[model samples]
Target chain A: MAIHALIFDVFGTLLDWHGGVAREASRLLAPVRPDIDGGAFARAWRDRYQPAMEPVRRGERAWTDLDTLHAEGLDGVLAQFGVEGLTPEIKRELVLAWHRLDAWPEVPAALTRLRGGFLLAPCSNAHVRLAIAHARRNALPWDAILGAEFARDYKPKPAVYLRAAEALGLPPGEVMMVAAHTSDLVAAAGCGLATAHIARPDENGPGTGEAAPAAPVDVAASDLADLARRLGC
Target chain B: MAIHALIFDVFGTLLDWHGGVAREASRLLAPVRPDIDGGAFARAWRDRYQPAMEPVRRGERAWTDLDTLHAEGLDGVLAQFGVEGLTPEIKRELVLAWHRLDAWPEVPAALTRLRGGFLLAPCSNAHVRLAIAHARRNALPWDAILGAEFARDYKPKPAVYLRAAEALGLPPGEVMMVAAHTSDLVAAAGCGLATAHIARPDENGPGTGEAAPAAPVDVAASDLADLARRLGC
Candidate 1:
């Protein structure tokens, strides 16, 4: 079947979740602790995101939502960073910051080009609201949004990708999964969706140095803009 | 709480499933059965879409996907039309026709505007794959793609809306639901998401005359572009 849709992994593929979180955390903590290693703190918090989903991903937990998981992970990051004197309102505000994260500069135009030829959606571990909010905030054009929430398991898991295909009403072969993380494409590949890898510098943590992402992908691009061109968008 | 996301009802809201199907049918039948009321066939076929979901929506069935329901409904419309000599391939083609339906001319622009402000996803009764495929074909920008698959239930049921919000990590009130259909918004309203209504002239049947949509939405606009403006997009 002709490729009809492109399912994207939002965090590193379209939006700069790592950079946005790093910046947002830097700003949020700056008022209290100027010495806070904003970059390190951001990475630390994000490092926990995948592991945090492990319990649910592994089926050890009865499917916790990302919001609650995010809160759990954030609480630990705060304590480890030795940040103090935060009110509940402030903490809640910080947690909601995930909703306002910025998109990479190339995303808007790239999305426009990609949409000309394919169905674009975020297939990610991000909470539905976070993904949707980010898309709205950043202007990532997607046809639908797919999340781990749909499968109750995070990406890199076959269920999530398969569920996404099921939702799109297309067989796995016709839909391609795009992500900056190779591990995500690997999972999507397992479910028969063609995979595209768009490398996001921030996601792999600076110079983990473009060591190939953990998953196997079909086409690798430098970013969304390149991915669009490769797909003939 | 800050509104983190928005979920929409697909059919009449995003794609003019009704109108598009009517137009396509007109083109197909106009050539062979010049005397056939292609418009009426279109309207009747479109009308069956929701009623077709009634079984799954009401818990009378075991949560079959929308494609199956559409097939069943398609068979009924075919029978009623007394259209003869339909092959299995033709039937399959006809049933899948819903997947290729066109969006209202206003959709792409309005969606562009709405996408500028909020996280947008669909909380529709359409199967996930169908929704995803439609978005790709139509070039909709959704952050997350949600469907009845999550809760194993259809819209009008609180579970569908609630599950979508929960997936997005937003409280029900923090998420908004947009649709051209009244009952869909009503259900979303019941779930506490802000609701917006778009007028779909072909929904009730061609020339049935567009009246005000059935319910009071937060804002009723000429179409999505108007909707985007009203939402501060």
Candidate 2:
């Protein structure tokens, strides 16, 4: 069977998380600290993402969804920046910034076209609720939400990729994992899923590293529109 | 937070599954047997649904998605109706009739309205792929797909209702189960979720059984549009 579904890595692959979060953080926190660099704060918070999930991934802690993880990590980032006296309501709103990220300009149109031919969903590290909220806000048009929470483990885990394919009743080979992150694609490929890498050059920031697949991907494109075209959508 | 999401029972609640399936069956099988009653054939096939899933629900057999169950049950229905010589391709297509079901006339508009206020999804026993197909065909606009496949268990099981709530990151009380079936509402109420009953008087063919709440529900309406109104969407 040909690839029947395409699962995406949401944060950078579908939505511009760094820019969205940074923008929100700046808007919310600028009054508190004039010296705060919102972009750096966003980077700092996201930098903790992998390490925060490591304990759960290694079985050192019980599984926790990404929303809880994001909230917990936010506290440390706030303290690190010496930003304090924020009310619980503000903190809650800030935590939800991840759920309000804007999709890349090409995403909605590309997904709409791709959806006509293949099932589209987010196979992100974000929890289901986060995925749902983000999809609603950004109009991602996912057929389903499958992610770290659904698999009860974070990405780069074989189970996450395998279980997502299983949930779609598709063999791994028939499900393509589309991600801007080379590591996600590599991990998905390891689990027998086909891979597509759509580069998001500004995912990290202007001067940061660009993702190149460590291993060959079935398709590599400049963005989701390019990916959609490459996939013959 | 008062019903953050409304999870629906898809087949009878959202789509006119019986009518749609019957119509498809009549179109596909009338050539072989002029006497074949398509509505009766649809009812007979659906009649086998619960019994087919009992083993899986009871742990007597490993989990099998509704698509496979429908296929297996179709063989018996074909034999029961004295229809034969259908190719594997034809049977496969017939089994997929469940996916191409037409939504009740009010479904799309009501869902679009409700979508503005709440996260909406089909908490059907249908597999994720089936749900995806149905949504694409009918423009159901589900925020996420959750059901038997996600829970690895069928409806009326507390696990199904509870897990759906969990996936939304909401407490059971904040998630409402909307169904045309009283039994599904009762089960959802038992799990501390609110319930809404949208009557599908023709669900089992006219005058067969009008679904009435065996227990008190949060809302009861003549149809999905009525339900949307009662829910203040």
Evaluated with DockQ, which candidate comes out highest?
A: 2
TM-score of the second chain in candidate 1? 0.89
> Which runs in model 2 stand beyond 4 Å of their true positions?
none
Report the CAPRI category for model 1: medium
lDDT of 2 by residue, B1-233 (tens): 38889999998888888888888888787677768888899999999999998998898988799889999999999999989899898898789888879998999999999998898888999988889888888888788888887888898888899989999888999999999888899999999999999888778678665556667899888998998888888
Residue-level lDDT for A51 in candidate 2: 95
Model 1, A1-233: lDDT tens digits are 38888887776666666667767777888889888876788678778887888887788888776667778888899999998887777677677777777877888998888878876667788766667667667766666666676677787878888877776667999999877776677777778889877777655466642435665567878877888888788
Please report the candidate that would top TM-score against the real structure.
2
Candidate 2 docks at the CAPRI level of high
Per-residue C-alpha lDDT of model 2 across residues A155-197, encoded as one tens digit per residue: 8989999989998879999999999888899899999999999
Candidate 2 DockQ, CA atoms: 0.82
In candidate 1 chain A, what residue range of length 10 has the lowest lDDT sum? A202-211
Cα RMSDs of all predictions?
4.0, 1.8
Model 2 chain B is weakest, by summed lDDT over 10 consecutive residues, at B206-215
Summed backbone clashes in each candidate are 22, 0
Global lDDT of each model? 0.75, 0.87
